[model samples]
Target: MSPQTCTEGFAYDRRARQCIDVDECRTLPDACRGDMRCVNQNGGYLCIPRTYSDTSCILGYTLAEDGTCNDIDECETNSHHCNPTQVCINTAGGYTCSCTEGYWLIGGQCQDIDECRYGYCQQLCANVPGSYSCSCNPGFILNPDSRTCLDVNECEDEPCSHRCFNTYGSFMCNCDEGFELAADGTSCIDLDECSFSEFLCQHRCVNAPGSFSCICPPGYYVYEDGRSCEDINECDTGNNTCTTAQVCFNFQGGYTCLDPLQCHSPYIEVSDNQCMCSAENPACRDKPFTILYRHMDLSSGRSVPADIFQMQATTRYPGAFYIFQIKSGNEGREFYMRQTSNVSATLILARPIKGPREVVLDLEMVTVNNVINFRGSSIIRLTIFVSEHPF
Candidate 1:
């Protein structure tokens, strides 16, 4: 054969006169499976199984041209019988099925796992298809870690009027000492101390923001007890408008003005020696009169041992006999007159005055033997003041 004129599968052979078959099976040993027998053909070779290990492969695997079993990735090839929630893993010669994160394998099937039963979340846990998520209850927020829950700070926005307190899963509004929580629970209101207790103030009640103050009415002031009220003396404080001639009398809640008593012109004595008036004078025809007055203040139910009034009268002539007689006014009802001598006399009150009153006394003096043989009279007015308290 020509060197360049050889058939497709046979090389030219100089000793051969015609074309002949080439023993490619013996020359190309790696043309088929490494462990199988190679059969020669007209132009190619065929590999035949020599042993069961050389021709067989385990499940999910196939025999390669090198006579070695190669693992089949059923997960990547989508050939595994695992469920959608399960994962397929490849082995040396086989594949295994397993459940995902939030699922469990049971009876060759994947089932949803209850992660909440295992205390997976601090507050609340919810299961998804293949995973679980953590959540929080009201008034709380989920932490960034996704497993723990944190309390929300409701006081950050100043929802309460006074104070705010935080608790587990919730928040509370608080008020100061003198305040109370409102109906909405987020605000604060002032407490009415006067409306709840009457003993807080003795006279008047004044309510303030966080407290209350006690007040006394007009003409009164707070007492030493700090609660009760006592009457004020307007006279002592110069608060009274009474005149100089008027007396200012203080009462429980107020003061009263007392007017001074005045006598008429005819009842008053203008001259000191009224008994010495001439007979020719028209005043002498009538009885000459002298007036005396005095004022006394005595506590109710108390008696005075001293005399209230004393008088001494002398005539122009000596050795004259005189007689004194109590005429009108009081009629000696509240007083008694004693004649120490013919010219002197003293008057004393019977008892303390029970009430305020004015006493009028009229005394007549008659001279038995005198140059003028005249008669004289004197008028005495006594004012008694009865006070309930010491002045």
Candidate 2:
């Protein structure tokens, strides 16, 4: 066998001891063009492609292992290669860039958008990158669905001192203590203090809606009870500064001195033009009078017997009525029976009568009814005297 030699030298066994030809096309048929075949002539192989019935991949595309041309996936290597708003899709040997739905794909990247145009929200809807948020108008709250707004509860917080009222998006707080709320929450009103006095200060209290006061009358002190007035005692303690002949009398507001005559009987001293007297005074006396005889209901219509005058009228006519007229010669003495049952009548004279001629009386019966059992006209006699002062 001969050793291999370089080019320009002759006569070497190229097929045996030198490089041999290889049929690369037969081993890698799928990697080469469909019409190309490998030829084995020398140390290297040559390709010869046949004419194809179908079209080949364009310049931007490369043949795949399966003999079909495919595009590259540039997006897989680094998403930053395309605009944030745009999506990269691989095709036969190239990529397609597009903006995401709902986005204008300006420079890439999704931005918050106003959805009010599509009426997506019940009231107002805001569009965000992969989603949307819902909100109600200024006066409302977002509903649980987050797609709509509902009424806010103003009363739940007890916002008002008197009353809490709810309106569109807010609430109102009311004032109750003799006051009212102004358009704004800062101002308040005061009720009339003079009115509703009862609820204010006690004991002659005057109410000024927001306030009140108490007062007392003159000469009287307001008692601890606040409602009552007590008179001051001017005579208490030794303030007996009155004159010896005068006695001091205490009045609600002050005191005064009385004289003897005004003090009447049972009085010791009197001065200052007042009268004071005692039981032993000469003006005190007892005056006496005699009652004249009188009769009534007599059968013969004769004058009553003189003896009727000897006895007192109390026993003779227990339950009968009698009338007596006294002669004026005896101080104008006269008497009349009391018609009412169980009642008594008395004949009193201002002066004492000394003799029988001093007085005379006429007696008579005015009426006789079935209720009376008297057999003869009723008679009555009596003696009387006048008393001083209390008379």
Candidate 3:
């Protein structure tokens, strides 16, 4: 026959033949609240942190969806231990525990042991009337015999964040060359070594994830020391676009292409920067007497519709109309000339160009003489060097 009432943790079944353990974990869901996983015992339920459960997933990180070591949102999936009454707070790798530390249980209860009063702990000691136990320091665990303490080797777990070194009782965290260990000693952040010194880069310093880069201006290059800038001699390095008819002159931060003071195609050198067509040759009567060469540098992926180069009439005359056009070498139609004024024209890039490449264009400017029946024209060979990288 069944008793009238069962014990505190035992519930009488329908038949009432025998008493069964009550599942307090299910019936009293609030029994284990706040990051406490409820484990059903024979007579009661024990609350434990999910991070310290028997199936702790920290060793392999979390059970990611792609079967990789990625963080799994327990709160989002309703897999957290927080009960309905408490708010679920998610941590980096796991959740904090609301449950108290569990005790080591033996087969049966016993009276106070006399040896415990003497104390046998490597770190702390506590003595009470009917109970006493030996405990180790924070970085140690009690041995099976309950009298010995063993040091905890934390480095074996992982990179405390990036790298770890286990010491006698605790561990130290170290980061790589380009990173620095955070204050928490379990995480790492990028180190901006460039900020330490302005001399680190001659012109500009670009900070990156794990490193930095020093950049120089267009007419210069980074020195071997990776900190200073040196002028690049475009004339000697053949970096200039000057044709055989022109000469390249290098300067501090730029280079210029100048006329060689020699005439070509029925033209004669007249002055320092001018030439004259032979009046005797009918074929040369309409040909241009002056030719010029120019070069420009641009970074890759430049925004289109940007003005690249401008040409202005150095010598203006009255009753003259100026017209500018791209004669040849603009096969891709990547550029067009916009006349800003009667005496000035601007070369506009029609589309963005990806480098490293060179674009050569033959531009012509004709001046119609309305007062006199004479028309003169000039051609400019322009070379645009697009850099492989954007500064």
**lDDT leaderboard ranking:** 3, 1, 2
Top-scoring candidate (lDDT) = 3
lDDT of 3 by residue, 204-321 (tens): 8999877999999787899999977777889999988989888786655556676666667577766655566765789777677566766677767788889989988888888998
Scored by CA lDDT, what does every candidate get?
0.64, 0.44, 0.71
Arranged by TM-score, best first: 1, 3, 2
Better of 1 and 2 by lDDT: 1
lDDT per residue (tens digit) for residues 1-391 in model 2: 1234333212233333222223344455554555664443222344555433134554334578888866545567552255665666543333445444444322234343446666778886777764577778776888777777788887886666567778878877777776767666735566566565553433366545555456544434667765455555555644656776766555443445544333334433344332333335555322111112222111111222212222223544445544333323343433333333332333333333232121344332222223575332322322222111110
Tell me which residue pairs clash in candidate 3. none
lDDT of 1 by residue, 292-334 (tens): 5545455444466557666667554565676665666665376
Query: Cα deviation of 305 in candidate 3 (Å)?
Result: 1.8
Candidate 1 vs candidate 3: which has greater TM-score?
1
